[model samples]
Target: MEEFIQEAYSGIFEKELVKEIAETAALIDFEEGDRLIEINDYIRSMPLLLNGAIKIMREDPDEGELLLYFLEKGDTCAMTLACCMGQTRSAIRAIAENKGSVVMIPVTKMEEWLGKYKSWRNYVFESYNKRLGEMLSAIDNLAFMHMDDRLLNYLKEKAKVNNTTVISSTHQEIAYALNTSRVVVSRLLKAFENDGKIKLNRNNIEIIAID
Candidate 1:
């Protein structure tokens, strides 16, 4: 676990801080679709991604789940940091996008390190800024872009995070992430296939054009 932590976060964190994290953090593995954090759940720790991807999502009463962003290796969720600092329940849901592991650092250590470690403080602030930008981009997509364009962007992002051109998700799963109907997603996917943007498979999509 310590070696994994060092390899993942060595340059981002100082040596002493890395040692402390290795000693204090719990390493947890997750499978695809596993919920790491749920809405309204009290956050007791923050996750440092060691491998794979985690999807951060927001739930709307009427629209259901909407994808906020993806956390890749060496990243942590800014929302989790905020909730930990504020001592509040999670407003978003975090699900494992694939089989992976994370080092979960206790919330108690977050503040202590924030004041004690320069690297930790910089990481926290940078995470907040990056996540805020992503949130803004999501809002722009919803308010300005067409559903088809949004869906295309979603596929591109999913493919990038999964490190594959093929997306192994059903149309319904894509619909849930985009907060749209399966019928709508299916129609757009067919149109995308017709336009040479993607290839439709029985249960997956092969992206041909991504920009």
Candidate 2:
């Protein structure tokens, strides 16, 4: 675990901090589609991604789920940080985008290290800033971008996170992420296929012309 921590976060965190994290954090593995955090759940620990990607999503009872952003290697969820600091329930859901592992640092240690380690403090603040920008971008996409453009961007992001051009998700799953109907997603996907941006597969969408 210490070796993994050193390999994943060596340059980002100081040596002493890394040692402390290895001593204090618990490593957990997750499979694709696993729910790491759920809405309204009390967040007990924060995750530091060592491998793979996690997609952060917002859910509304009436509007449904919306994908906020993807957290890859060397990234931590800022929303989780906020919940830990405020001792509040999670407002967003975190799902594994692929098979991965995370070092879960307890909330108690999160605050303790904040004052003890400079690198930890910087990481926390940077995470907050970065996540705030992503949330704002999500809002901007909904308010300004057309659904097709939004869908294209979503596909590109998904492809990038999973490290493949092939996205192994159903149309209905895409619809849920975009907070739209499956029919709408299908229509737009067919249009995308016709436009040579993607190829429709049985269960996955393959990127062709799309970057």
Candidate 3:
């Protein structure tokens, strides 16, 4: 995990600031199926993801979960920012999508770190900007795209984010992201799989090709 942090910082922060922040970080590991934070739950401190991914979702009338996006390594959870601003009842739910490690930083300590480390502060702002952009994009898709179109586009986007046409996520999870039902997702996925565009592996569905 230290290696991952070093790598993440090497790409994003000054070496000295990286060491300072890493030194102050306390690793919190979660198992694959853990629920790191539920809907509307508030955090007293901020957490930095060091390894693996978490799904950020909201409830929809059509389903169990609606995936807003993901918090990958080097990304901070949106809830952290919301909590910092003293907001209650987050519209997003954060669940551990896989085995992961988080660095929980006390809000006071984080403020001190930001004060002492200029580069780290800038890095945080840049990350938040990227997240805000993604949130806006999600809103745009939800407002304009058809459910099937959204699902296909989302799978395509996730493929791009992972740098491969193949990813190990599930139809139900994808449905959650699309704000639709897994049964409908399954029907579409079965057709895609039959058409040789993807393959299903238990809970994980891999898109083999887009075209």
Residue 97 alpha-carbon offset, candidate 2, angstroms? 1.0
Better of 1 and 3 by lDDT: 1
List per-prediction Cα lDDT, in the order shown.
Answer: 0.93, 0.93, 0.73
What is residue 138's positional error in candidate 2, in angstroms? Answer: 0.4
Ranking by TM-score: 1, 2, 3
Can you write out model 2's per-residue Cα lDDT over 87-188, one digit (the tens) per residue? 999999999999999999999999999999989999999999999999999999999999998999999999999889999899999999999999999999
lDDT of 1: 0.93
Off by over 4 Å in 2: none
Q: lDDT tens digits, residues 178-198, model 1?
A: 999999999999999999989
Best by TM-score: 1
Which pairs clash (backbone N, Cα, C closer than 3 Å) in model 1?
none
Better of 2 and 3 by lDDT: 2
How big is the positional error of residue 17 in model 1, measured in Å on the Cα after superposition? Answer: 0.7
Backbone clashes, candidate 1: 0
